[model samples]
Target chain A: DTAVSQTPKYLVTQMGNDKSIKCEQNLGHDTMYWYKQDSKKFLKIMFSYNNKELIINETVPNRFSPKSPDKAHLNLHINSLELGDSAVYFCASSQQKTTTQETQYFGPGTRLLVL
Target chain B: DQQVKQNSPSLSVQEGRISILNCDYTNSMFDYFLWYKKYPAEGPTFLISISSIKDKNEDGRFTVFLNKSAKHLSLHIVPSQPGDSAVYFCAADDTGRRALTFGSGTRLQVQP
Candidate 1:
């Protein structure tokens, strides 16, 4: 069984369109995160949620929003997508909010292409 | 600015040899470091990690060395195998933030 799962392994949409990526974790983790990897392969954190509450919000644009329905699921919704938004989005989860040796488990990334 | 940096874009090593990858971080608040190996179209898998209190951690053939004074860390793979060929990412956990800052990955190719 997959510990972390994301839907639509690939997504292609026109610029200015809105799209969503869904993520679910079966590990019963309380903290979930979203990371974006650009073409240059620079991985950056966009958002982090702990117990359905926003904990960390990076300098990402407001067009991108994260919604956590429960502790096991966190979904990302991007509004007015731009060409620069084309990147591989990864969802990850960690058990505790603050652990020195905390390990994050990631899902197969969702490659989004904005035309 | 990038808090964590992996200067090497790519590295090549012969199978059964030793492969070392280095990473540096500017943030002193990071108390934990990890090394992840990623394959094409897949998420990164945790290979090894080290806490600030420890200088080294080892698992099987993989070892991670952390230097808090120099703000540097390294992953060493002894007898590197062909399956070890993948993009290696260095991530740091900022104390109390619970968020990880990742460095630009280094692609390692282990020639058979």
Candidate 2:
């Protein structure tokens, strides 16, 4: 069974289209994160949510937003998508309770193609 | 600026040999370091980790060495098998933020 899962394993869209990627974790984790892996294979964190609350927001553009309806789910919506935004998006989850040793679990990435 | 760096884009090793992957970081606040393995079209899976307080950690044939003073770390796999082939990413855990900063992954190919 997959502990973390993401929808739309592959997405092909044109520029200026708005799209959403949904993420869910069945590992009963309290923290969830969204990361983008660019063409260079560099992975960077975009946002983090703790118990359905926004905890960390990187220098990502405002057009990108993360919604956490609950601790088990975190969805990313991109508005006015650009060609530069075409990349693999990964969703991850971890259990954190003041411990510095928690490892993150990641979902199979969604490869978005901006045509 | 990139905080974490994995200079090598790829590495190749023969079976039953040693494979060493190196990573360097500029952020001194990172208290924990981890290695993740990723195959094509799949998400990364955690392989091993080392705390800043400790210099080394090992499990099975995989071992991670951390050098806080040098701000460098390396993952060593002895008797590398073809099954161990994958893209290896070096990540650092931001102490208070609880977020990980990952480096550009290095693809490791263990030839049979």
Candidate 3:
């Protein structure tokens, strides 16, 4: 079984369009996170939620919003998609509330291409 | 500015040999460090980790060494096989932080 899964492994869209990427973790983790990997292979955290509570919020664009309906689901919605938004988005989950003891499990990334 | 850094972008190693990947961090508050491996079109998978209090951690063929004084860490893989080829990421997190800070990444290719 997949511990964490993401919908739409590949996404190709036009500019000014809105899109959403869904994520679910079956590991019963309390924390979930959204990360973006750029073309340069730099992985950066965009948002983090613990038990459906917003926790870590990086300096991401306001157009990108992350919503967690429950502890197992976290979705990312991007408005007015721009060409610079083309990258791989990954969803990750960890068991405990702290990062010190929890090892994060990630989903197969969603490659987003904004044309 | 990036707090974590992986100076080498790529490394090539022969099968049955050893592969060493290095990482450095500038944050003093970081208490835990981890190594993650990622194949193409996939997210990173946790490999090993080390706490600031300890200097070394080993898991079968993979070993991670931490030098708290220099704020540097290294991952050593012995008898590397072709399946070991992937991008390795170094991540660090502090006690209060819920998210980890990641280095750019280092790609390793093990030739068979």
Candidate 4:
């Protein structure tokens, strides 16, 4: 069984269009996070949710919104996607809301291409 | 600016030999350090980790050494095999922070 899974492994879209990436974790974790790996191969955290509560909000633009309907699901919705948004997005989860002691499990990334 | 850094982007080693990956950090608030391995088109998988209180942690052929004084850490893999080839990431986190600061990454290739 997949501990964490992401839908639509590959996404190709046009600029100014909108897209959404969904993530689900079966590890029964209470914390979930979204990270983006840019062209430079830098993995940075964009948002984090703990038991459906927003916790970590990075300096990401307002166009990108993250919603967590339940503790097991976290979805990222990108509005007005730009060429610069072409990158790989990953979802992760941990047993606890904090990472000081637990390891975070990650899902297969979603490769997005904005044309 | 990136708080965590992996200066070496790639490394190659012969099978049955050892592979050492280095990482450095500039943040003092970080209390835990972790190593993650990622295959192509996949997310990173947790490999090993070390706490600031300890200087060394070993699990089988994989060992992680941390030097808090220099703000540096290294991962050593012994008798590396072809299956060990992958991109490794170094991550750090603070006590209360929910996110982990990651280094760019170091790709390791073990030739058989």
How far is A28's C-alpha from truth in model 2 (Å)? 0.6
Error of 2 at B69 (Å): 0.9
Evaluate every candidate with DockQ and list the scores.
Answer: 0.80, 0.86, 0.77, 0.82
RMSD of 3: 1.2
Reference-based lDDT, residue B64, model 4: 99
lDDT of 3 by residue, B12-87 (tens): 9999999999999999999889999999888899999998989999999999999999999999999899999999
Candidate structures ordered by lDDT, highest first = 2, 4, 1, 3
Task: Name the runs in model 2 displaced over 4 angstroms.
Answer: none
Q: TM-scores of the models, in the given order?
A: 0.97, 0.98, 0.97, 0.97
- Number of the top candidate by DockQ? 2
Winner by lDDT: 2
Q: Candidate 3 on A7-97: residue-level lDDT in tens?
A: 9899999999999999999999999999998998888889999999988889999999999999999999999999999999999998775
Query: Residue-wise lDDT of candidate 4 within B77-112, one digit each (tens)?
Result: 997999999999999988588689999999999999
Please provide, for model 1 over A23-85, each residue's C-alpha lDDT reduced to its tens digit, 9 standing for 90 to 100. 999998989999999998988889999999999999899999999999999999999999999
lDDT of 2: 0.96
Better of 1 and 2 by lDDT: 2
**What is the lDDT for A107 in model 3?**
93
Going through the candidates in order, what fraction of the true interface contacts does each contain?
Answer: 0.83, 0.90, 0.81, 0.83
Model 2 DockQ, alpha carbons vs. true complex: 0.86
